[model samples]
Target chain A: MKIGILGSGNMGSSLGLLWAEQGHEVFFGGRTTEKGRAVAALAEQGTQGGTNDEAARFGDVLLYTIRGINPAEVLTSVEVLSGKIIIDCNNFEIPEGFAYAPIELSLAEKLASQVPNARVVKAFNTMAQEVFELAPSPLKDYQVSVFVCADDAQARQTVMKLAEDIGFTAVDCGELRHSRLVEGLGNFIRFMIIGQLQNPYTTLSIDVLPAASEQRLGGRQP
Target chain B: MKIGILGSGNMGSSLGLLWAEQGHEVFFGGRTTEKGRAVAALAEQGTQGGTNDEAARFGDVLLYTIRGINPAEVLTSVEVLSGKIIIDCNNFEIPEGFAYAPIELSLAEKLASQVPNARVVKAFNTMAQEVFELAPSPLKDYQVSVFVCADDAQARQTVMKLAEDIGFTAVDCGELRHSRLVEGLGNFIRFMIIGQLQNPYTTLSIDVLPAASEQRLGGRQP
Candidate 1:
């Protein structure tokens, strides 16, 4: 699969390298191609670096990791985004590193609205860049959940597959509207691990224990 | 410990029974005392029933589980709530059962503002009432996290202890202002488990894996 990373920051670089290692063609895009090229130079596989607009046109699947800027403004540089699977990994935070004040629509939802033609999937915004750097092997025993939410079912499935391929458990949160909750979970995680616990290595996962009836049934359906 | 339950709903009743079994004196309070009385009657311990105002004045620790109505209006019935540790176990949801539109202050935060003199601690709002009914023994192996947050450190610790006593792994989420994030987590869990997976038996938890350096050090500090 061709994956375009629309930022040259830690998250984009780490994910780009990881995908490159997985034999996916990765294009690292940046405001200036220098940083993207430097990141791409580290990869031995089918990886390259270019301008954001070039990267946007290069891949069917795009990892939108740019922060601070309005996504609509950024996407305007690209000619078309229709039918493209845009995996949004952006979380809005204030200067204090906490989440921005609650808004009516989440960042992902806003991005979707901005680029109505694009199949927007919200994923990978919950964890830090360091998490992507230490993916799959180091945390194989523990299930690190990557929540994926999208209005398009197929896009959601595609992004979930990408997450699973990277050795993380992907939770399907359903619908673009549900991005608000996912973004909230992202902020909650940041507040707990970074703000409260002072632990950067931590991540959140779900533990679904069997019901009493399920236990009594001994694997049999009720 | 004298624990006052300010509602006769499933959450209030379940927690009231749990605390009662843990040897705490519990006062189950409701709009009308009949439901509270019936729930309290199920416990063969130092437990009783009363009206909301009576319960508010009865215990050193109070469980604020009343929903729908504004907290200020409910607390008005009581003469005073100064210095009392209030465990806020309420999550605001619309009639459709999804979380209410995102607001500036969380329900717990709003409650804290309403009762300025009370020591407000947010906890037990993330899980379903049935989870409390299951208790510690059934979920002994799983580390089900109960996120506790309060502006007052002592109140936070008190709530954490109560959560631990009930056999949950209590996570200290620092200040009460972070309640917004916790509430967001509650909504995320609901959307994923009930709305998406259609599984009422599931819950979310944190899985903090060791860092690469920690793994390499083999119990030695760097």
Candidate 2:
């Protein structure tokens, strides 16, 4: 698969390197040409680095990893990303302390509205950059569950497969509107680790488990 | 400890029964005396039934289980609940679809502001009534984790102890403001099960796991 990473930041570079190492053709792109080239050099598999516009047109799938308030401005410059699967890993700014932004409109939803033609899927925003560094599988006993939400089933499946490619258990979390919940979970985890648990980002990854099968029957037994 | 359940609903009744069975003095209360008495009958230990006002005055700690739009109205009617630990388990109504209510001010925060003297702790709103029905432990391999949050340390600890008494592993998730995150997790779980997974309420319970210890060190080891 051809993978285009739109930012040369920690999250973008980490995931881009993982995908490239997984034998996917990856293009690392950002405002800083030198940093983009430096990140692309870390990949053992086929990889390249260029401007955001060049990378946007170069891939079957694009990862919007630019951590900014508005993604529309950056993405609008790309001439041809129509019908491509765009994975959104951008989260709104965390205010001082641990309180998250009051999510009136989700970033994924906003991006979807901006690019009417593309399929936008929300994933990978819940965990920190250190989490992505442990690709394919974490050192934990439980699998790191990634919640993927998108309107298009095919697009969601593509993103889920991409998540699986790097060793994440992707759970379908329904439509684009459910992005609010996913984003909220991300913020909550951050708050729990930093503000409450007082633990560093490296020590923890969000893992969800299922209930026992026998307990599935509704109502109390006589 | 004297446990006052201010609503004879499923949540109140189930928890009140468990606490009563655990040898705590439990009082079940609601609008209807007959219903409160019937709920109180489920408990084996020392328990009683009465109106909400009577229950409010009867205990050192109170569980507000009445599902209502405004909790301030219900709590204001009872005088002298000052310095008492109040556990809030009420969740705001989510409309027909998966969209959650935009909670600008959390119910726990509102209740805290309303009754300036009482200590408010938000908990148990994440799972369904049937979950409380399977008390002491779930059928799964791991113990179910319950998250407890509040402004008052002593009050939070009291609620955490109460949660543990019912066979739950209570995790302290910081101050009262973190209630929004806990509540959001509740809503998100609901959306995933009902809206996305299309699974019925009987089939699920929220389960969270811990990460490995070695993974806590920041950055990759080159």
> Cα deviation of B83 in candidate 1 (Å)?
1.7
Q: Provide the lDDT at A158 for model 1.
A: 95
Per residue, candidate 2 scores C-alpha lDDT tens digits across B1-222 of 998899878788888988887789999987767877888877767699987777888889999976554445665464567888889887777668878865576778877887788898998876666566556544123445577889999999999899888777677877998788777877876675556655433222223322333555342342
Regions of candidate 1 where Cα sits further than 4 Å from its true position: A70-77, A95-99, A216-222, B44-46, B70-77, B95-99, B216-222
Colliding pairs, model 2: A202-B216, A203-B216
Indicate which candidate wins on TM-score.
1
Over the stretch A62-136, how does candidate 1's per-residue lDDT look in tens digits? 999886465556654544688899999987674374644885788998888778888999999877766664565
Error of 1 at A163 (Å): 0.5
lDDT of 1 at A156: 96
Cα lDDT for residue B217, candidate 2: 37
